[model samples]
Target: MASQNILDVVVVGYGPVGQTLSILLGQRGYQVAVYDRWPSLYPLPRAVFHDHEIRRVFHAMGIGQDVESISQPSATYQWFNADWKTLVEIDWSSESISDGPVGYLFNQPSLEALLDRKAKSLPCVAVHQGWEAIELHERADHCELKLERVTMQDGKVTRSGETQTVKAKYVIGADGANSFVRKSCGMAFEDLGFQEDWLVIDLKPHEGVKLDVPDIGQWCNPERPTTMVPGGPGYRRWEFMRLPHETREDMQRPEKVWELLSPWVDPEQATLVRYALYTFRSLIADNWRKGRVLIAGDAAHQMPPFMGQGMCSGLRDAWNLAWRFDLVLRDVAPPALLDGYTPERRPQVRAVIDASIAMGQVVCTSDPLKAAERDAAYLAGDVPPLPPFPGLTDGLIVRTQNSADGGIAGQLSVHGQVQNHGRTMRYDEAVPTGFQVIGLDVDPQACLSDAALAALDQLGAYTIGVTHDASKVVANRVLYDVSGKYQQFFAQHDAKIVIVRPDYYVFGAARSAAEANDLVGMLIAEIGLDQASAASKSHASAVA
Candidate 1:
């Protein structure tokens, strides 16, 4: 017999990604349970930096200010050479992010602790601590989760000796690299292990050694490109290239570690706080979704630490997937709608993987000549250290033009408007309910009796008539350049109404009143947000 209990989502693995997912889903009114095997978090410095996008999500969750207060902001990046020579130093503090929070650094544990608290504070969220998931049950309409609860001390053990089953509409796996869910789902992970081991050391450099690091540091040491990044005051991190056949067993001795650090350390004054061995693999699950069971974070993709994107990638996964479930829970969409996840996210994850591998090859090079070539590329602006993609770059949503380029009303299209100004631009209001259309050349009388116009206004779409000004003209969309205010900006775009989605994706150019009506219908169906519309209602019946 199936359990009659109800849950919107059961997030497997309550690490950073899972926890963040739970909070977002819970806030959206979904009954979410965040599961993890550990009773509490481990205190250690693992990953240390987060890009501006992470900070933005935290802020959206209402903890952005608190996270900023606790985090050490590093807006500067520096790369070095074999002789500890400086190559490129880019100040990140002044970066322009398209959306979400900017760059910040916190030790892994501290960040986890904060997320743990946030998860607990969520209204409809449950933190299933000490619960180990042993099996998954995905049915046509729901999923059943089987878990084991455990408790143990330094020398004793006490446990429930029982299994708990949770019935949820959907599930997500956020476990680490060796993810049980990924394996259980029968998903294939393309594991390409070129270099597998690392000798990592975590410590704080003395005053004379610490650079006013914006939060990250990359070393181009040819013999061993050892990267040293500050975690917090009196805390830093070092990742050394593992020498041939040098096992962790051989490096257990403090003296042996001292010898490793001697080249860069002043033999008389340096001390090692924590040192251990690590391994890395470039693995991406062939797919992120399988039935009702899904995976995110390291469970989804694993790459080298060259780009500091591992955790950030998983967090983005949680952000993207959680919202889909929210739509399902509200009964506005069918569960199968989640199928779109893999196509949208896999490409971005692969891009991150390729970028990580390419970056690792560049920074971890032992050849002095090749190292110089890499540095020259950076200096000459031949390449970005890490290429920007959708999730990491504020989840970009580019516009799509209709036939003849502009909206049905081809005369008012802003087709080629590109924002090149140094200003960080943003729409004054959040997404409206339905569709938004920006019309630079508008008939003020058009607002009356325009069903599309009324719907756009009700939904908070940006259906505005424009007469551009010389000020702030770059990023803002300009149409029907009557005043010649955005002369340069308009030079690229034609006159037409530009339609922006609630998700900030451009749905289409509103070519005509008739096209505008059809475009709104298209978005309503695309997002599965149409609750009472007859067209969407009829589509639902046809699918059924």
Candidate 2:
């Protein structure tokens, strides 16, 4: 056992979510300590899908190039009936607000490995593998974690006979579904009444082997509900719903795997990388935060993999919480700001889970008559449209019900290419982090009153005026909208100015200059910017 100074955050579980949070914090120059049970990276592929939103997080993490290198864009995803008729289709390759494909297929192992390397590369991050959090104690201002090292022999766990204690200002549980921190915080899960066993198999084709497999489709056959999809480069995956009479052992047999995958490709032709039975269920934590402790990722929610949002949701949680932590840790905002995380994320996650469950119900039917009815309805264009990506509805977002009243609150802002001083880059790269007051060919600073301008400045918001004309990029603050997406976005909202939060969600918008000042005023009052500033000054004075 050894002693160390109190860190900014002690993250339990160095999975994707934990690693992401650690890297984000470390990048902000905060000290982070990560604990995980495994001695090294987990080589198996579990989640093989990521949406554009998660890709945005990768961009924030400075790993967009690595992600793009190892990921493949998904094409149309189709649902088929027992007879292989297309019941419904979703354009997975559709453009996202982040200016990329809506969905991507990737090997989870490679993604995690890249994240691990990135997190460890940061001087502020301490990645302690082979260490597990055994206990957690929550204090008024900090959290204490008891960690231990365990030795394994022949895949069996044994005590390494070593233990240590670490103290941090906050603790995050990204420790998968069976999160110790979630349990330690005494949170309960509300089951969403969806649970089923499915067998997942990952296959990698030998170099230069041309193996035939069905397009990414959900076979809604009552005989055996199954999913067939490409698993990024050099890989393929299939999921089979277990029948009533089948047991876990029965499904895990090599013969059963071959039997299930036989329809797509002969198992003998491709290499069997891994196969395992998983119980797909829908559950969300009753509470995501308690005292100084919080949970994210699989520890907070679990949804069926039909929508491929399981991992994406967790990553979103990490992204959302990381920004909030940055503000709170810097004393720019009160701890109450963290209160918005659950209210904002829970609804989004619930919507995703509900959609996944509904999709699973449509694809997991064991009745032929129902499947036929579904097929007929879809063919008749009577089926429900695929739900749009969920947005922040009630948390920290400003909104107005009246269409005549301007407000794009709670919605995510669009990212597009921008040219600043002859350098072309994404809007996110050009604009500084924190709050951003963006205008369409107009300077938002001209709209704010002196008090409002002071408030905005205190919140660390900067104004960026974007113009569609390339000649308008004469100043450092005025960017050229290279793709015209920003212009179109403002026109669609009928807004002259928009207030974007650091996490890229639209806080509010204004249709006029006066209204922009009013919006800034409202934000200052709503978020208690003045009070925070006063309190911060008082604290600094007291410390001096």
RMSD of 2: 3.8
Question: Which residue pairs collide, candidate 2?
Answer: none
Compute each candidate's TM-score over C-alphas. 0.76, 0.94
lDDT tens per residue, model 2, 47-141: 98998878878988889989989999999999888888888888989988888888999999999989999998999999998887888998787
lDDT of candidate 1? 0.63
Error of 2 at 236 (Å): 0.6
The number of clashing residue pairs in each candidate reads: 29, 0
Per residue, candidate 1 scores C-alpha lDDT tens digits across 204-271 of: 56666733432466777777667767665456666777655567677666777777666556445545
Model 1 scores a TM of 0.76
**Worst lDDT window (10 residues) for model 2?**
535-544
